[model samples]
Target: MSELLLNHLAGRPQAGSGPGTALSDPVLGTELARVDATGLDLREGFAFVREQAGAALRAMTYAQRAALLASIVKVLQANRDRYFEISTANSGTVKNDTAIDVDGGIYTLGFYAKLGAGLGERRHLLDGEAVALARDGSFQSQHLLVPTRGVALFINAFNFPAWGLWEKAGPALLSGVPVIVKPATATAWLTQRMVMDVIDAGILPAGALSVVCGSSAGLLDALQPFDVVSFTGSADTAAILRSHPAIVRGATRINIEADSVNSALLLPGEAPGSDAFELLVKEAAREMTQKAGQKCTAIRRIFVPEALYGAAAEAISARLAKTTVGNPRNEGVRMGSLVSRAQLAAVREGLAMLQRHAQVLHEGAAHALVDADPAVACCVGPTLLGARDPDSTRAVHDVEVFGPVATLLPYRDAAHALALVRRGQGSLVCSVYGSDPAALGAAARELADSHGRVHVVAPEVAASHTGHGNVMPQSLHGGPGRAGGGEELGGARALNFYHRRAAVQAGAGVQSTLA
Candidate 1:
């Protein structure tokens, strides 16, 4: 075991294994750390957050809360080197991919800090103008927003340990609610380390931020009526969480961002070697290789026009062939292993399901090793498959191979492309590529009906546009239907989740006094 788990209620870095689990490195297949939160009192932890941390945070101005976030940013920046190394060792990601988790977390906090400062010191947020209840306006009602008197329970996915935690906690703290984070068991080391750092530095009040790295044993049982739970994972897990007694009874609020079969569409006019076509091919390969394609939002389906199907397949295969997979620490390695052996098994199972309808275009095979054993590491080369009959292929549309894998499908026209896009049921994001802005925008608009976000990658804007897989802090990150139909990280709009909006009915004198 590396060290004791961090339990905020037990005064940070609580010792003793006490029936726990070991976290192993995906690249080296060695024990990296241990997680055990058995001794923690869930009831007492919840109580401390509600009575102490919540009270202290509720009393502070938005500016003060933002200052706390800024302090957190400083600390994370100082320790970024250690975080990068941990990410490589534990998560099996290259420096570029690790930056998406570690530096992305820091950037999100910085964004929230500035946004919180702009919100000013008001404890209550006004919603529009006061409503008139009488002809003379003596009686009126004002809709105001106040912080929830409960904690935020975050059950994060394995792919993004650092980004997932801060993205949720930043808004909760700004909205005056405490946080209890439960990261996925496989790669919780990075999250545990960050939480320990925060607690040790006294960045926030005790109970304001806590973490449970192992099983979420008694955490959900301690939720109250006013609490909120944010989860990111598979659809099956989301269903289980949605059916919890507290959630079903409306005692707690649950927001889920589940797995999605996100798609990338190539317009008809773009030829094989054109800039738009090249961008589409490059982006599809990038999404597949980045983070070993473990991202929930990674493109699982690529839709190309029927004319460019053969060329598109060839181009994508070439890109995957050039990608280097092995230990992330090596300078030449472009991609790394999956998070663990279990994840590798899961990806292989998913690929088996996908192979029923699609033929392998590029079978991901490791060509070189960077001072690591191939059998021990959970590495998989980038794989691409071609699905000629996408209109009737059920597995290509539904089954998601969560490793560096993608399926290529062909569409006859714009209508056919849109049809295939909708076949995904719902997705977090989809992209359209072409030379004509007018055509691309119109098709993207049609595709947007089934996607949370649609990026129109015209040749003009392809250079500056963020890739299809990148999630920005300023936009909505969740989608409807199979994508979990929840919204998150829309800048200050995210703070709404932790606040309760109520309409106050009273006379003018009462309204004035309340203000």
Candidate 2:
């Protein structure tokens, strides 16, 4: 049996298992108890989530709830080191990179806490004024944002177990709804630790947050119309879940944030020998290596002016060659391992497909690392490929090497570049590199219909740009079409996903009759 699977089976606690032993994984460096079968049963889990939503709403006033949220932030800060350790062990992220995930996640919680406070204070506005005496001498009209009685089931991807969960939970919790999180097994340990912290803080109601490890099993089968489901993972799985009979027959509300072949474009004015050329290389390299290229938002396609195709290839290759790959714990280790060996294999498969339509400019598949275990962990060197033809299936689209991999496609013109990017159908993000405002605006508008978010990066804006791989709390995280037809963050936009909006009204004489 695989080490991961063996560890999973061994970690299952007996009914009488002692406290620490019941939930501890010596290999993974974390203690997380598996949910009792009774607690994890779909029906019971649903009931628990629903009841917690009510209790969470009743336990505190708006101010008190906001205060509880603030307390969560403090707790997360104090436990930051512990969480980072868990992240590194389970997800292969270095402490520095993992720290960003923890910090950003904490910020998300804090943002929603403030949002909850704001909503509570402003809810009175939603309570529309009761107009005095209608013609029949009766009060009339009212409006409010009430919580949905159903639960929220969040099925998350392996890349971001912590951030993804809180991103969904923060909004739902603030909106007075309960959430059930199912983290990917490979990195479930990190999520378990964070959730335990929340539970121990005594901020959330008992049932406000519950977690399920291992397979989803019967979770989706019993969903109701009032329940809300959100997912972040591959497109194929999203399709399967979306087409489930229960989801389709009962019309359950579902949101998906899947993977996509995202791209970036360099304008004609930026030849390879120019400053713009160097900037493009740096940007693409960063996208390929940061988070070990695990981000769903990373730029998978690089479109360069055909005249400077060779220059662009060399520039990117040179940058990638210099990147150091090893254990994230080691100093100066710029790139780390993929989340797991399975993920490394998946990325290799993606590169194999790209070989048909592109030429590899740089290969880091074989390298001697100073200190890291390849068997227990896996790391792919950064790879850069040049598309044989912009219009080819493997050139601008139809492939995504999830690890530190990128393809450079040469476009005949701006129009052709836009066409190549659009072939991917829809994506989470597309970035354009150029100093000309007209060029940036033109490319952005042309590709606007094809991408959910477009970021313009030029020498002028480069200083302030957050780069291509990071997604902020206030921004929408999902893309269109193949990327998943759903979004995760967007402040109140995410909160509304857990709620059902119904326009309630009564007959004009109803109010008079009641009085």
Which candidate leads in lDDT? 1
Candidate 1, residues 254-302, lDDT tens digits: the string is 8889979999999888877999899999999999999999998899999
lDDT of 2 by residue, 1-515 (tens): 11221111111221212122222322233433443222234675577567655565545555566667788889888998888877766676776668657787888989888877776543212434445445763545544456677778889988787788888888777666677787776677777668767776777776677676666777797577777899888888989998997688988889898878888888877755666677778889888888788888888999888888888888888888888887777777777778766787798887888777677788876555536655545777888888757774544477677888888888888888888888887999998888888988988898877787888887876678877767777777777788887877776676667656543355556533322
Estimate TM-scores for all models: 0.97, 0.87
**Candidate 2's TM-score:** 0.87
Residue 9: error of model 2 in Å?
20
lDDT of 2: 0.72
Clashing pairs in 2: none
C-alpha root-mean-square deviation, candidate 1: 1.5
In model 1, where do residues sit more than 4 Å from their true spots? 10-17, 366-368, 512-515
